[model samples]
Target: MIPDVFAYERPETREGALALLAEHGDEAKVLAGGHSLLPLMKLRLARPSLVVDVARLYELSYVREEDGFVCVGATTRHHDLATSDVARASAPLLAHVAGQVGDPQVRHRGTLGGSLVHGDPASDLPAAVLALGGTLVVEGPSGRRTIDAREFFVSFFEVAIAPDEMLVEIRVPSNPGEQWAFEKLTKRAQDWAIVGAAVTRRASGVGVALINVAPVPLRAAAVEEALAAGAGADEAAQLAAEGTDPSSDFNASPEYRRHLARVLVRRALQKAGF
Candidate 1:
């Protein structure tokens, strides 16, 4: 499959890229690492008239400490995250998920912002972000706005980012001593998860996020609430599918997905020593 002909512009600055998006609006698409968008474009599922490439925006390609949180630029590649000592020490869950995203080639080219902004329900990073309670910084003509990861994803391949906005950075607080686990079930090592679970426990509370359980990456509210109420891991994990409306697809039946969700949630909880 070939993508429809489209104009491309490599923006050296973030504002330049934003300007392109501001002008083209719905007809434009942002190209970060291009791992996700290029595939959709190649299949003709997305045929934007213009591609605003931000890969060369050096300022948007870093992993740094901001205040007490780790601020990752939108163009920072997954391989960087997977290999960064700062990320591994403070946000081990993110580093672990990054390594699990795809094969080495995909990780070398896939960006955290691209994965989160692409908003695929089965993606690893989004679920990890949700579990880690991260925030997305989106820049637009009106300036910037921050959206919590839990509220960032709206539906399958859908996010809260406006058409004219571009994700600039992701911010996550350091969780050095937190217990975390990510469990994904897939037919092949590099394949997308059929169903996945990410669990994290801090001094405050436990967070449980599910992948491929609904229209969007979702935190298991029922399970979280049960944990908060002092329920055991097995008891809380049994409710992992509560309120989810998963669809039956070629890879799995709705019931099968629900079952996987429960199994993975329980395993994640156990690994987190819940």
Candidate 2:
């Protein structure tokens, strides 16, 4: 498949990119790593007239500890973040999930900000961020703002980012002593997860998020509330699909997805030592 003919602009600076976005409005699409958007464009599902390439924004390609959280620049590649000492030390779950995304080639080219903004329920990074309770920062003509990961994914293939905004950074609080784990069930080694679970147990309580179990990457609120109410891991996992709205596909029925969610959540919690 070929994408419709389009004009492309590679901005030299962060402000330049934001300016291009603001200028083009709805017709412009931000191009980061392009691992997600390019495929969509090739399939003709997203036919933007202009592409504002921000891949050259060197200023937005870093991973470092800031305040009490680890900050990842939006243009940072998955391979870079997965191998980053700062990310690995401060946010192991995210680092590991980054490595697990797609495969070697995809990891080398996919951008962390791109994946989050793409809002794919099947993606690995978004679910991990949700479980870690991270935040995303975006810039637009209106200026900069932060969106909590929990509130970022509004629905299937939809997010909180405005059309004229370019995501700039990802921030995750330090969880040095937290027990965390990720479990993904895929039909093939490099395939997307049929159902995925990520868990982080902190002094406050446990945070659980699921991938591909609903229209959006979802925080397993039922599981969390159940656990907070003194339910055991099995009991909490049993409610994994309580508030979810999963659909049936050739790969799995809704009933089957619900079952996988329960199984994966239990495995994740057990790995996190419940």
Candidate 3:
């Protein structure tokens, strides 16, 4: 499938890309690694008049420790995250999840910021960040602002990023020794999860986030509350899908997704040492 004709601009610097985005407004689409947007364009699902390429923004391609969190530049690829020593040491669960996204080729080409901004409920990274309690940093003509992961993901395939805003970085707490687990229930090795759960257990409480269990990536609030209230893993797992609204597809019924949520949450919590 050939995409409709569009102008392509490759900006060498971050500010340049943002400027193009601002100039083109709704007519522009930022290209990171092109894994998500290119497919949409080829399928004619997206038809932006201009394509702003930011994949060469070298400054936005690092994983490092800062303050008490790990700051990952928005253009950092999944393979980079998966193999980054800083990311592995500071946020092991995130590194592990990055390794599990798509396949080797996809990981090499998919950017963390692109995946998050793409706002797919079925993507692994969104739910991982939700469980890790991360924040997104965005910049636009108004300057920079930070948004929590919970607030960033608004609905199915939708995010809080304005048309002129570009996600700059991902900030996740440096939970160096926290027990964490990610369980993906996919039909095939490289497929998207039918249901997935991410768990991070610390002395304070448990953080649980679910993938493909709602229109947006969902935090298992009911399950977390139950865990904090002294209920066992099995008891808390019962509430895993209590507040979620799973989507039914050919591969899974909503009821089946709910069931997988309960089961996967239990297993994930157990792995997290609940």
lDDT agreement with native, every candidate: 0.92, 0.91, 0.93
**How well does each candidate superpose onto the true structure, as a TM-score?**
0.98, 0.97, 0.98
**TM-score of the candidate numbered 1?**
0.98
RMSD of 2: 1.0
Cα distance off (Å), candidate 2, residue 41:
0.9
Q: How well does candidate 1 score on lDDT at residue 41?
A: 96
TM-score of 3: 0.98
Clash pairs, candidate 1, are none
Cα-based lDDT at residue 35, candidate 1: 95
1-274, model 3: which lDDT tens digit per residue? 8998999999887788889988989899999999999999999999999999898888999999999899999999999999999989989999999999999999999999999999999999999999999999999988999999999999888999999999999999887888999998988999999999999886656789999999999999999999988898899999998988989899999999999999999999989888
- Cα error of candidate 2 at position 250, Å: 1.6
Superposed by TM-score, candidate 3 places the C-alpha of residue 69 at a distance from the truth, in angstroms, of: 0.2
Number of the top-ranking candidate, with lDDT as the measure: 3
- Model 1, CA-based lDDT: 0.92
Question: Which of candidates 1 and 2 reaches a greater lDDT?
Answer: 1
The better-scoring model by lDDT among 2 and 3 is 3
The RMSD of every model to the true structure, in order and in angstroms, is 0.8, 1.0, 0.8
Clashing pairs in 2: none
Model 1 is weakest, by summed lDDT over 10 consecutive residues, at 57-66
Instruction: Please give, for residues 100-182, the per-residue lDDT of candidate 2 as tens digits.
Output: 99999999889999999999998999999999899999898889999999899998999999888989999988767778899
